[model samples]
Target: MLSKKTKYAFHALTYLGKHRDQKTVLIHDISEEYGISHKFLENILLELRKAGILGSKKGKGGGYYLIKEPKDVALSKVIRLLDGPIALLPCVSLNYYEPCAECKSEALCGLNKVMIQVRDEMLNVLENKSLADILDKE
Candidate 1:
């Protein structure tokens, strides 16, 4: 399941990507347009800025903007940034791997084998899909 934060991050980024030519976009505008809470959206945008996915400006006519091209921003990166690991089980996680407490050997575990296949298939789609690909469909 995707977290609300991750969903909101995608919404915000998609909005910015669509309006990339604009100098900046006010948070309130995005919040209002998407019916997202201003405060929550603010935090999401701040995190993205810190991640170097977004850039912001202060003062009059200043707001958030996408720093990287939409094609350069992978869906997997955004999801992982906001929602942590993509794997359903900790043992299956590639970046945040942890041995299962009950499982003696990952190679011998039935669940681990199934989950690895699941994770790989999911990653194939996520890693290949970018913000630009998403927007192009729309």
Candidate 2:
């Protein structure tokens, strides 16, 4: 399950991707379109802008826009940015790996083994999919 922050980030990105032709999109417009809280959506966009995925401007006609091309923004990047690790367990996480306190050996842990496979499959899809791919589905 994704946090509302992550989910709303996706919604904003998808909406922006769909309207990439616009100079910039107002935060209120996106929040109104998706029923997301304006302040919450503003924070999410700020995070994305800091991560270099998005760019923003203020004052008249200024708003947010994609800094990177849609095809260059992978689903995995967005997920990791807003949702943290993709793995079910920290023990199975690639970027956020931490040994389980009770587990004697990860090499011998059956749960670890199964979760590795699950994580790999999930990554295979997410890493390959990009904002452009998502936009195409609409």
* Model 2 lDDT tens row, 51-92: 999999999999999999999999999989999999998999
Q: How do the residues 1-138 of candidate 1 rate in per-residue lDDT, one tens digit apiece?
A: 999999999999999999988999999989999999999999999999999999999999899999999999999999999999999889999988999898898888999989999999999999999999989977
Model 2 steric clash pairs:
none
Candidate 1: how many backbone clashes? 0
lDDT of 2: 0.94
TM-scores of all predicted structures: 0.95, 0.96
Note the residue pairs that clash in candidate 1.
none
Please report, in order, the local distance difference test score of every candidate based on alpha carbons: 0.94, 0.94
**Clash count for each candidate, listed in order shown:** 0, 0
- Candidate 1 has its poorest 10 consecutive residues by lDDT at 100-109
